[model samples]
Target: MSGYRVGDIQLDEPVSVLPQAHIVGNIIAPRLRVAGMVYGSTAAHDTIILKDGQIWGDVHTGRLEVAAGGRVQGWVSSLDSADYQRIREEGVVPAIEPGAATAQDLPANGRSVTRSDAQNTLLRRLQDEAASALAARVELEQTFDKRLQEVAGETTARLA
Candidate 1:
């Protein structure tokens, strides 16, 4: 009517226009049926039906359907970038997350057994190994020192 007509355009029988329909700009839709006049480009996704209208611009679409008394003058292009931005903006995907798992919750296999259980097991094993190694080193050092003292005492007795 007032603004640009889009979507499906249907016509019943033979209808003629006196003044004629003038499309100042582009017309983008899935289908277009023109029986009057179009001065601008006409683009349709499925089909573009030009009955007896006079198109001034180019007609570029997926399919072009022309009747007996259809006339085109200007260039017509397909609807590619017409609704691309709207679709991209509307079709936004949100990110998903599994449950919460921290470093302390990891087991020996890096799997989550239990948070405090895994941490306690790791800490207890480390402490036990460190204590055993320290005790062995201390015993070896004491044995070496005692042997050195005995050798010194034997040398002093021999000199006397």
Candidate 2:
């Protein structure tokens, strides 16, 4: 509540979300650093840091910092820092990993992939596929409901 901060910056009250914590609902607070699983959206007046966690819903905050290993399936929106007329905002900056870089950032000279790297690649692909399937299922359910309602409406009109 007190010592939780953003990099070298200090916040009045910043809540550090733990890895064991799984929130089924949204979180609206001054500052929040996510190291856990969040099933719902997260909105922070100051900042929201996604550090090695999964967020299934949108994230809205003044400042956002996503760690290299973090996963966010939803949109991330933020207001301009200059527009912050309230309390001074502090960012929960994630620690920089030594070799955290995208494929584009890597040198064109490709090195042979190691066994561990290949395993990790496969694991990430599996995780992504599962997430995609889950999202598709939700979409399919919504569409089915709408179609069912339309069919019911047409049948009622025909009977009437």
Q: Residues 88-159, candidate 2, lDDT per residue (tens digit)?
A: 343332222223454556477753442354555565456546555654565566679999999999999999
Evaluated with TM-score, which candidate comes out highest? 2
Over 1-160, each residue of candidate 1 has an lDDT whose tens digit, in order, gives 2222322222322222323443344444445666555444444544434555555544556566666777655333333544423323443211111123555555668764444645655554554454345445545666799999999999999999
Off by over 4 Å in 1: 2-19, 76-160
Backbone clash pairs for candidate 1 read 55-73, 56-74, 57-74, 57-75, 58-74, 58-75, 58-76, 59-76, 60-76
Give the residue spans of candidate 2 off by over 4 A.
1-12, 48-50, 80-160
Best candidate per lDDT, number? 2
- Evaluate model 1: give its lDDT: 0.47
**TM-score, cand. 1 vs. native:** 0.35
Clash tally for model 2 = 0
Provide the TM-score for each candidate, comma-separated: 0.35, 0.42
What does the lDDT come to for candidate 2?
0.56
